[model samples]
Target: MDLDRALSISAAGMAAQSTRLRVVAENLANRDSTGQTPGADPYRRRTVTFTNNMDRALGAPTLRASRIGTEPGAFPERYEPQHPAADERGYVKTPNVNSLMEVMDMREAQRSYGANLSVIETTRGMLMRTIEALRG
Candidate 1:
């Protein structure tokens, strides 16, 4: 049925967004993480990529988490001479993650997941109603 296809599509979307949420959470948790050794690189922000793939059974394109990769960029430096990760010049390389950006990404992922869940619930409700009417 078309409703079954709807459920499948929405479920795929929810799964993809779930991965995004996890990545965002990890980035936020490591916002202040730094390398232990002098002049070593710190944590890099993670990025999630979404892709649409053909689902043969559903005969439709479904969303998926395509890749989870690190964001390539220079780490921000902080003047912390006492920190173990500090370089010879007294500059510590902090993680590339931004707390505010991670929070925003998290919010977007949550909203996307919630929207997919709502679609599944609505489709299920409609299917149930159809079955109930048929038995009448």
Candidate 2:
């Protein structure tokens, strides 16, 4: 593939990974969030889904964020009778976000983004070298 196409592909990958990282960060940030009112649901963990779309201009498939949806998992129940949001059963609904899982997902997304950035940098260097060689 040409250097321009390579850069474009990597850029798309970086964008997708950036979005993933953002979602992961949001999940981590809201991990401890609880409902304000009694018997109300707490913050739900968000998830990102990616898709490969054909870029007509580049004539290549690029990764895109297909959807940002809530996790379909049940929230954990914490027995905190003193809490303001406790239900009649003296249970508070905790967010489904697990800090460990969010941390791992964030790390994975960061590595993927770094890899894509490296690809762009390498392609740029190669293109510059080609130009220099032609001038020489």
Candidate 3:
């Protein structure tokens, strides 16, 4: 495969991973967020979805973030009678965001992003060498 095509594919992957990281960060930031009023819903965790498509311009497969959606898991309830957002039964709906899970996801996204960046750097180096050889 051509170096240019490899660079394009890697760039697309890096972009997708960047979006995933952003989504993970948002989830972590809102993990403890609760509803403003009693019986109101709190912040829902957002999930990032990706899809691969053929980039006609690049003539290669590229990845992109398809959509950002909410998780289907039910919100856990915490008993907090004194809290203003608590229900009549002294139970308050808490966001389903888990700190550990978010951390793991963030790590994975970071690793993937780094891998794509490495690929881009390697490809650029090879291209530069090829140009230097041709000139020499």
For candidate 3, give the lDDT of residue 77: 95
- The RMSD of every model to the true structure, in order and in angstroms, is 0.6, 1.0, 1.1
Off by over 4 Å in 3: none
Off by over 4 Å in 1: none
Q: Could you tell me which residue pairs clash in candidate 1?
A: none
Whichever of 2 and 3 has more TM-score, that candidate is 2
Query: Which is the leading candidate under TM-score?
Result: 1
What tens digits encode model 2's per-residue C-alpha lDDT throughout 1-136?
5778889999999999999999998988889999998888999999999999999989989998899999987789999999999999999999999899999999999999999999988989998899999999
Q: Count clashing residue pairs in model 1.
A: 0
TM-score of 3: 0.96
The lDDT for every candidate, in the order shown, is: 0.94, 0.92, 0.92
Local lDDT at 10 for model 1: 98
Q: Which ten residues in a row have the lowest lDDT in candidate 2?
A: 1-10
Model 3 Cα RMSD, Å? 1.1
Q: List the residue pairs that clash in candidate 2.
A: none
Q: Any idea what lDDT model 3 has?
A: 0.92
Using Cα atoms with residue i matched to residue i, what is each candidate's TM-score against the true structure?
0.98, 0.97, 0.96
